[model samples]
Target: MNAIAVRAATPADHPRIVDLLTRSWGETVVVGHGVRYDAAELPALLAERRGRLAGLLTYDIGSEGLEVVSIDAVVRHAGVGTALLNAAAELAWAKGLDRLWLITTNDNIDALRFYQRRGMRIEGVTRGGVDASRRLKPGIPLVGDYGIEMHDEITLEMRRPVGSGIAQPG
Candidate 1:
């Protein structure tokens, strides 16, 4: 396999990015932690392999930290997701941000494991949070991966030590 190239997304990538987000998440808008975000409107990173788009990660930078609004790899277990995530972390570190965080549904066991293995820890859980999310995006399914009932939102975070520079992924 060709090495994956990670880079900041340019405006020219918007149409493809919007298509990817729509296909992956059911629409361009994603609801997390009670906020609805049009991921296509956010700054993002793109991962390409062999000159083809392989993955994308959209993020929001705030005074508190950087929030990963969405991440999707077209090919699973191909390092595309990891590369996008690492690039996001590096961007956050460059901006002097101290933490990187994201929200995933409780039913997304795969995501929980993925983030945890990459050095993120569970920061909080909002029980039945998906219920409120449904108000914003009714397409959120009643069930998710592994036949699990979707319910809560799990917030996972990795904190960069003060003045420690970039935090490496585990």
Candidate 2:
């Protein structure tokens, strides 16, 4: 397979990113920080392999924290997700940020494993977090992957001093 290339998304990538997020997340609206983020309009990083959109990651950096709002990969198990994650970490570290964080549903067992393996710690698990989120966007389904009821949002994070390398599996 061709090497994946990662870069900051351009305006032209909007429609495709929207489509991908819509299909991947069941919608294009992401709820975080008690507000909604239009994933397509947010600045993002895109990963391309063989000229195809391999993955995309959207984030928001602020004094509060750098939150990875969304990340999806069309090519599974091809390092697309990992590359995007590492790139996000590098960006956060460069900006002198102390941490990188994201939220995923409790039903996302795959994501839980992936994040932990990639050196992200389970910072917190807010019970009923998804329930609160649904109040903002009712489109969020009650049931999620593996037919499990979605009830909570798991917050995961990775932290390192600026200029220190992020951990990666061998």
Candidate 3:
């Protein structure tokens, strides 16, 4: 198996990134925590295996922290997702950000498990958050993975320790 290489995404990668985002979320626009983000226009990290795009992570940096807008791994369980996430954390740390966070739907059990295993903890659960999100991105499905109804939004976060100067795992 080839090693996954993580790097910052450039303008040339935009089209491919948009395509991937569309395939993953039904479009390049994503709604989370009541805000709409055009994922293709955001700063992104890409993971490649043997020159093929294996995973992508788009994020937004704000006064509070860095928010991961979207993350997708084309080939699961192959370290692609982990590589992308680690790169995002390092980027946040380099920018002096103190926290990394993201919002995922409740029905996305895989994402909840994956983020938790990767050192992020559930920060909050907004009841009926997806219902509010659907007003922006109407394509959001009524049901998601594992035959579960998608309703709430789960916010997860990893806080960088004060004075550590590095992003900490867990």
TM-score of 1: 0.95
**Model 1: per-residue Cα lDDT over 113-166, one tens digit each:** 999988888989999999899999999999999999999999998888665776
Candidate 2 structure quality by residue, lDDT tens digits, 1-170 = 68998999999999989899988878889985466888888889999998989999999987756789999999789899999999998887777877889999889999999888898988888898888988899988899989999998888888865445664321
Which residue pairs in candidate 2 have backbone atoms (N, alpha carbon, C) closer than 3 angstroms, thus clashing? Answer: none
**Candidate 2 RMSD computed on C-alpha atoms after optimal superposition onto the true structure:** 2.3
Q: What is the lDDT, from 0 to 100, of the residue 132 in candidate 1?
A: 91
TM-score of each: 0.95, 0.92, 0.95
Q: Could you tell me the TM-score of candidate 2?
A: 0.92
Q: Which ten residues in a row have the lowest lDDT in candidate 1?
A: 161-170
Cα lDDT of candidate 2 equals: 0.86
RMSD of 1: 1.5
Model 1: residue 91 alpha-carbon error in angstroms: 0.6
The alpha-carbon RMSD values of the candidates against the true structure, listed in the order shown, are 1.5, 2.3, 1.4
Lowest lDDT 10-mer window, candidate 3? 161-170
Q: Give the TM-score of candidate 3.
A: 0.95
What's the count of clashing pairs in each model shown? 0, 0, 0
lDDT of 3 at 7: 92
- For candidate 3, write residues 1-170 as lDDT tens digits: 69999999999999999999999888899999899999999999999999999999999999869899999999889888889888888888888888999999999999999999998999899999999999998989999999999999999998887777665654
